[model samples]
Target chain A: NAGVTQTPKFRILKIGQSMTLQCTQDMNHNYMYWYRQDPGMGLKLIYYSVGAGITDKGEVPNGYNVSRSTTEDFPLRLELAAPSQTSVYFCASSTGVGETQYFGPGTRLLVL
Target chain B: AQSVTQPDIHITVSEGASLELRCNYSYGATPYLFWYVQSPGQGLQLLLKYFSGDTLVQGIKGFEAEFKRSQSSFNLRKPSVHWSDAAEYFCAVGAWSPDKVIFGPGTSLSVIP
Candidate 1:
């Protein structure tokens, strides 16, 4: 079973470019999350969803939006990417509260 | 509000030597703590966590973490360092229920042969 799968393993976007990073999990987990990792910054939560159609803002949700159309899919949208938004994005899911989150391979994004 | 602090920005250890990474958290209530390791170009992998039960928790890859309630710290330790263990380690904390997890500035581990 594929735990979590992310698309567009790597991408480069110019200023004002918009794109979506797709994340899907086959674990049928109830909790899904989006995070970005930067040098020495560890991982900061971008957005999260408890279940389908129920998304919530997280610690660093200023420049992105997310949608949870299905239990297996959670996609992040960057309307106008900026240089600061360039970071490795990760998707994760957990079976339930206080559970270990399984992470996807990650998508490397660079905004020019 | 909840926060995590990884005091060590970077650490260097000789192979076969013991290693420890410090992590401190500040939360109003009981905190759920976690340690995740990230290799080059890879996503974060769970090493260990602390929620309840025993204070000491053993995790994969010969790593372990001890939860100290009084100190509000959950420190990760390895008996011996391995070359493959060189990576960035993150400490995180959150509420007992699912929500946003606060992450500290990660500690990068370098193992010398």
Candidate 2:
């Protein structure tokens, strides 16, 4: 069912460049989340959505934005890419809060 | 705020040997704990979770974890290690929401034949 899917598995961006990371889930989950994982560190939440048209900031939401236009899609936007933003970004979804979240393959971003 | 700690950064065990990975968490109220495994170049997969009741929870790939409330620890164990079990294991604590979950730094497991 393609539990969760992300686009451009690997990407490179220059300083100040902007991009959008696309994520889609077929699980019909009501919750979606964005997280960034740095080397030697655990994942940090960037943003999340409770349902379509409802989004909220997470632990590390700075320099990032998200939108949940449909139940199946949640996209993360980077307004101005910076070196610190270079990390692997993962998208996940769950049926509800506290449910087992299914993750996508992840998008590796490198800012030069 | 909830947090998790994985004491071991890396561990090595011979094939068919017993194995254990330690995890500790801090939270104000009853904790919802989980263990996930990640293989190289792959996404994280749920191994097991603990909500309430049973202190011992079974997971996939012949793995199990014991939750000790007194010590605030949830340790993963395997009776017999396999080469395929070599991966990074993460312990996390959270409430009912996924965004509230906090992950540990992760422990790397290596199996030698």
Highest DockQ: which candidate?
Answer: 2
Top candidate on TM-score is 2
Deviation of model 2 at B92, angstroms: 0.8
Which run of 10 residues does model 2 chain B get worst, by summed lDDT? B92-101
lDDT of 2 by residue, B25-98 (tens): 88987788899998988889999999999899999999999999999999999999999999999998898665
By summed lDDT, which 10 consecutive residues of candidate 2 chain A come out lowest?
A92-101
Best by lDDT: 2
Model 1: how far residue B98 lies from native, Å: 3.2
What share of the reference contacts survives in each candidate? 0.74, 0.66
For model 2, the stretches where C-alpha displacement exceeds 4 angstroms are none
Report the C-alpha lDDT of model 2 over A4-34, residue by residue, as the tens digit: 9999899999999999999999999999999
Writing each residue's lDDT as its tens digit, candidate 1 over B39-60 gives 9887889998888899999999
- Tell me the TM-score of model 2: 0.98
How do all models score by TM-score?
0.96, 0.98
Query: Chain A TM-score of model 2 versus the true structure?
Result: 0.99
